[model samples]
Target chain A: MESKIRVLVGKPGLDGHDRGAKVVARAFRDAGMEVIYSGLHRTPEEIARMAVDEDVAVVALSILSGAHGSLVPAVIEGLRQDGADDVLVLVGGIIPKADVPALEQAGVSRVFGPGTPLETIVAYTKSHVRRR
Target chain B: MDERYLTLSGIPIKNCYRPDDTRQLDYARDLADPGNYPFTRGIHRDMYRGRRWTMRQFSGFATAQESNERYRYLLKQGQTGLSVAFDMPTIMGYDSDHPKARSEVGLLGVAIDSLADMEILFSQIPLDEVSTSMTINAPAAVLLAMYIAVGEKQGVASQRLAGTIQNDILKEYIAQNSYIFPPEPSLRIITDILSYCAKEVPRWNTISISGYHIREAGSTAVQELAFTLADGMAYVEAGIARGLAVDDFAPRLSFFFNAHNDLFEEVAKYRAARRIWARVMKEKYGAKDPRSWRLRFHTQTAGCSLTAQQPENNIVRTTVQALAAVLGGTQSLHTNSMDEAWALPGEKAVTIALRTQQILAEESGVAQAADPLGGSYLVEALTDEMERLAQEYFDKIDRLGGVVSAIEKGFFQQEIADASYHYQNRVDKDEYVVVGVNRYQMEENVEIPLLSVGQESVRQQWKRLERVRSERDGQEVRRMLEDLKECAQSDANLMPVILDAVRSFATLGEIMGTLRSVFGEYREPARF
Candidate 1:
């Protein structure tokens, strides 16, 4: 029996643009990963709670509201405080290039922006999960 | 690779289109002359020949004072009209000082907390001299009321105001998830706006039935048209059910569409939309006034199509999309800035975007003719096919008990998700070509100076919000909010009370909270 990789895809804050989040979630499902989608307007605490509750290997945060600077750190901290620090965090959506380094420093393993191929994201997730 | 040909909507395209392809299309009934019934050629006979479409660039960011400066600058730079973009907090009906709004205040767009913010937003710009379009929903009534109050303060009569409020909430459920109220009460607020604007603000376009967000959400051109028109039908039905005459409110109805990369398909989509809307308004609803049937729409270049890699290529992409919009006969067009894929556009990039429209309208002779691609065999065939596919979708939506019910059942959401996934899959497989991304790869670093909203603006906005709260009459605000909550409990039009609240300087969050107490919040059902 194969062990399936579980991932929780979350949208935090007030950003309603979810095309990227939904597409990535579908890609994960097609890649044979068990995916849980945290629907729109979720707070960081709620997303982190769902990540712990789902006991997922990966927690992907998607936000296009430009609030990622503040929200992404909060989510990462929430996960750390909730003792889910082992879960890998990934970020995507309309994040600026300048902000990517700060987000990485805050513990986002990867930041995918517009025009990023889903295969790249899938491959990155698989490799990171395997290493973990 | 096998040679496959199809529109983005998955409609197979022939190698060559001939007269036989459109044999079923009657010129008199289907492809009538421009500005006539069942307007397929174009909505206006003169089209751009008489007056070019309004070059209204959607611009807003940081504080209202900064956004107002940008608006004034754009007007000085030859922008014909103003289209305001609100931040996520404003769009979600949260006050700037709210904890949930912290970090999001004026991030994506300007944050408006109350009538004070709206006044600052329109300062120095004479309301009667210019038109404004606000991209707001959920709390659209509150924003529109604020606009009306601003106009009154500027000494402009309500009847003299000419602009549009993107009051289309159905698409919020379908594509954008920024909705505040549930479906039933959302439609009621929309109908109330339609009724109120028809009687009081006679010149105002109450709602802009939008397909822009639908396309941005990854739906195909055909789905954008189909879902948007279906939503428009639902609004009309709601208004008629509320005892308002169809013609009374239909004339103020407008549309908004997206101009994607496929120029021919996009032109065909616009043409088919006008034809179908004209037919629906006349044949189905029995609208006698021609203005009611004329499907005037605003177009914005597709933001999803813009690329972060070799961002300069986005200018060319925006130009192509803007040309398609002009060729398709958009009443107004907004060209997306190149830097948008990364962050809010800087000054230089936004100016170039405005220039893209000006060059298309002035230098390029594409706007001289009405529907330049009207009689082309391929365009005509594509137009007919788009109409047929959209009609099929309309029938399916009708069978599911109309747009609102279909939304509740997650029909539109599922379809968009499927389409978006398919598109992404193609890109992943290298089946689709996105220049500078999957193809023509580059290793050069992006060197554009991205615009960053400073923390000072957020602090200032918070301070301003606190000042408004302290300065406003507390008694009047409380009384008006009470009245608004009471009105929300009943079927009485909430617009009047909402306007009263706006006039009393009730904050957006306060007003939305009152209504939320009555209408309750909406929780979207699981899609997948």
Candidate 2:
């Protein structure tokens, strides 16, 4: 029997738009991954702390408030400070194309924009997550 | 390829619709003349002929001063009313300088920390001359108190003020998730506002029971209508339990809905909403006044419908959706900007969005008569079908011991998730075509300049907040907050005490913090 991959879906910052987060979380669940949803209004530190505590292989942070430039990197930094650097971080929501490379340089493994297929996210997670 | 034809709500659409399709719908009963009982055609008899719908643009970003400039610009451009959008921190009941509000201050909307900020927001605009709509929940009472304070400063009595507070917290639970306190306390606060506004702010819309966020959360049209109306019913029940008469508050009750892509489906949804509310209010709640049954709503173009691939296409999409709202007989409409898919709308983009409504009202002949598409075979059948589907949902909700219990059981969330998943599957399979998204591929760079809130604005906001805190009388602020906490503890209405707190220059976070001590915070149960 194959071990299920674990993923934590976090909504960082004060943005209340959660439809994308909820939808992606469900997609992960349906794809047979162990999914933990961090509810709304979570700070970057709280999300990173949850990721480290849960021992999840991947943490996907969703934001729509265009504060992604600041919030996403903070999440990455928080994870690094906690020494959970191997947790593949994926950013999703309404990210502009120009910000993709900056987010990648900031340590995000992948950035998914609006209208990206859920299957693509699941596939990316399955292939990229490092096994401990 | 196998044949596929269905509405976003999963209703099977026939190959063609004709008179036979609407044979079961009674003209006098279900399809009565405009402004009559069971107002399927429209709530107003003259509709746009009497007066065009209010072109209320929802605009706010950065600091209060900057947002005020934008509002003044919009009003100068022939915009009819003001709709204020507070920043995330303000909406979540946090002061601008709070640690949790870092990187989020003035990012999405204006950061209003105290009455001073609200005063700046409406600085030059007279409260008596203009109507304002605020999109703030969880801290709606605090925001309303600030608005009333601003009104009093302008020498406008509370009874003379006209505007709305999107104080629909139940939808916050069901869809938006911007709630602070738990469900029971939240409902109590909502009822308190309804009761107080019945006497104090008679012209003010106490609650804009919203389906807009529900639909934006990916619920089907039918689910949006059903869940929203269910939440509305919950508010009415809470008000009645508080010993307030239905007619007193119900007449001031209003609704907010989404205007999505589908033309006929969106129009039919609005018509069905009015009919169902009329029947339910008259039959179940025994609302005597005809005004109590009317479902006046504000429509906003669907933000989710906009695509980033070819942002220009969004203009056409918004125009179509705006037309649907006008034809659907919306009392007010907010057309979304084309560049919203990337960032908050810039000045040029927002102007075009508002102009879309202007062109539709001034040029397009669609609003020449009430219910322009009233007798269309397709529209009437769809309207009847929408009502039937919503009724089925109401029955299921009733069986689950009503909306509050159903929310506890994750009923509404599950339904929305299932519907969203189904729609996404269709898009993935190319069964449902969204131009510039799943099809009509484009390979060009997005060159539009996006709106960016600077760190200077955040710094300025924090400085102002600190100054306000230092200047205000500490003893008075403490006393007012204590009085507010006492009101929260007892069965008394909370609006007056909250007003006093605002008048004393208490910050939004201080008042909400006091209530949190008594009511506690809410954490939504994970369903996925």
What are the per-residue Cα lDDT tens digits for candidate 2 across A16-126? 788888889989999999999998889899999999999888999999988899899999899999999999999999887788999999999999998898899999999
Which lDDT tens digits does candidate 1 get at residues B176-280?
Answer: 889989999999999889888888999999999999999999999999999999999999999999999999999999999999998899999999999999999
Q: B1-528, model 2: which lDDT tens digit per residue? A: 224667766688887898899989888988799999999899988988897899999989999999999999999999999999989989999998888887889988999999999999999999999999999889998999999999999999999999999999999888888999999999899998998899999999999999999999889999999999999999999999989899999999999999999888999999999999999999999999999999999999999899887899999999999999999999999999999989999999999999999899888888899999999989999999999999999999999999999998989888887777778878878889999888998788779898988999999999999999999999999999989888899999899999999999999989998999999998887655
Model 1, docking class: medium
Candidate No. with top DockQ: 1
Which pairs, if any, clash in model 1?
Answer: none
RMSD, model 1, all Cα superposed?
Answer: 1.3
lDDT values for all models: 0.91, 0.92
